[model samples]
Target: MLFKFRRHWETPWEVVDSKAVKPVYMYYDDEDSLDIVAVSDADTRGTYVFEVNHLTRTALRNAVTFSRQQLIHQVAKKGFNVLVLESWRLTIFRRGKSHRVEVMYSGRPAEALGKLPHLPPPPFMDVLHEFM
Candidate 1:
């Protein structure tokens, strides 16, 4: 099989919990994947890490086909009792007895809408120290 890949930006993101909220910065390696760097104003539940196998064609498409409304229901069908997903390619794995529910997302609004509005920065801010 043949494959093609492109790199996204190394940008800061926001993570909002029920009572507390903070910012998280994500960086990309030349390896075609991103890594979590820091969370502002609050500590992470732990150093949560995710290495997306963008090559997983089937899995990636299956994840994206759900309607905006069905996204939550599809995730619940897996196992998570309570779930939260970010706007971008960040997913949260919630605990379950035999397994956990995984929410997979990627912020490709431009790809989805063909054109998007010029949105402002997140409420919180952080910097991306370029990997040297």
Candidate 2:
């Protein structure tokens, strides 16, 4: 019998905070996995964390795949957080702000793209409903 071992990728946490919304910590793995942790209280006692796998990532990417103009319009019309993750970078948009982070895989650095032009409805809505 043969056994296969998978490599583990660790992403350092990046935190974003604002007076209007809860603080959010975002990070990604080498396999295109995204982890989002939202802190609900000032004391960081209550929290909600979402871990998205490759399948969910694919669905999200497909759902938001739109022309630049279309994306800008959709984002302006709907207020929701959007995340785009590629092999080398992770981009996030929330509350009209955008940010990009470089991703390193197996200790190799990768290039990052600019902020996406548009926003799509949150792809994790269904998963969120399950917990509520």
Candidate 3:
């Protein structure tokens, strides 16, 4: 087996949530974002860490999704209920015989002033729900 191979960046593409509103809201850039400030307590450059032996082919499409969700959970622990002007980078590589996916996201963390609104899921989300 080759010790080194060219790395690819595609696995991270499948695990993305484009929803505009949620408990931990996400925005790609300042052009369309909320009025919030960046909090320093949260981990901005969160890395995806996992064991290769536990990797499964079916889970590949959801790896980045998991990473981002984990980051949000951690930030919430720090009192951040929302994130704005967010961006993420994805990486795909091989560990031994398995292909692994990772995601690192950066965003301005903020606490919503009042009760965060929780609207019904977008109509388009029904397509996703059906697959579950």
In order of appearance, the predictions have TM-scores of 0.18, 0.17, 0.49
- Candidate 2, 69: how far from true, in Å? 20
Note the residue pairs that clash in candidate 3.
none
lDDT of 1 by residue, 1-132 (tens): 297544465332323111112323222234232222322331112212333343233432333333222433443344321122223232323222221113333221111112323333321212111100
lDDT of 2 by residue, 1-132 (tens): 397654456343444321111222223445233333331121111111223333234432333232222433343343322333211112222222332222111111122344433333423324322211
Residue-level lDDT tens digits of model 3 in 62-85: 554565577668778887876643
Alpha-carbon lDDT of model 3? 0.49
Off by over 4 Å in 3: 1-43, 50-61, 115-132
C-alpha lDDT values of all predictions:
0.27, 0.28, 0.49
Question: What ordering of candidates by TM-score runs from best to worst?
Answer: 3, 1, 2
Q: Candidate 2 — which residues are off by over 4 angstroms?
A: 1-83, 86-116
After TM-score superposition, the amount by which residue 92's alpha carbon in candidate 1 deviates from its true location, in angstroms, is 9.2
Q: Give the runs in model 1 whose Cα sits over 4 Å from its true position.
A: 1-55, 67-69, 72-86, 90-101, 104-132
TM-score-better candidate, 1 vs 2? 1
In angstroms, the error of model 3 at 15 is 19
Query: Model 3: which ten-residue window has the lowest total lDDT?
Result: 119-128
